[model samples]
Target: MSSNRKTLWQIFRAPLLLGLLSLTGLIGALVGDGLFDLISWATLGSALAVIAWYWAKPTV
Candidate 1:
């Protein structure tokens, strides 16, 4: 039998990064207009894409 071990950082890194990006998007939406608004939309869209991708995955 083989067992693979994962570290805390490995597990949390993606979620933390997504959280940071989403937070930045929220702040950008609040802090400015024009380019910042566009950036915020793009970042939020990327986050939603990731969520949809994960949600569509097959589970066993």
Candidate 2:
């Protein structure tokens, strides 16, 4: 991979990957007619919040 692409992936990889996984699970749950909307939302929301927090204040 190009350095620029690698750098971009390094910056966004975790959140993007986790978010995609969460979205997939959320869609699966919804399509399966599961009554776990709140749980899914909370899980995804918390993941997003953590990602935002880390982006805002990254500590080495």
Candidate number with greatest TM-score: 1
lDDT of each: 0.88, 0.72
- The local distance difference test score of model 1 is 0.88
TM per prediction:
0.81, 0.43
Instruction: Give stretches of model 1 more than 4 Å off.
Output: 1-3, 58-60
Candidate 2 colliding pairs = none
The alpha-carbon deviation from the true structure for residue 39 of candidate 1, after best TM-score superposition, in angstroms, is 1.1
Per-residue lDDT over 1-60 for candidate 1, one digit per residue giving the tens place of the 0 to 100 score = 236887899789998998888988999989999999998998878899998998998865
**Best candidate, lDDT:** 1
| Model 1 vs. true fold: TM | 0.81
Per-residue lDDT of 1-60 in model 2, one digit per residue for the tens?
Answer: 254546677889987877886886577568655456666776667777877988999565
Question: Candidate 2: where are CA atoms >4 Å away?
Answer: 1-6, 33-60
Q: lDDT of candidate 2?
A: 0.72
Question: Model 2, residue 4: displacement in angstroms?
Answer: 13
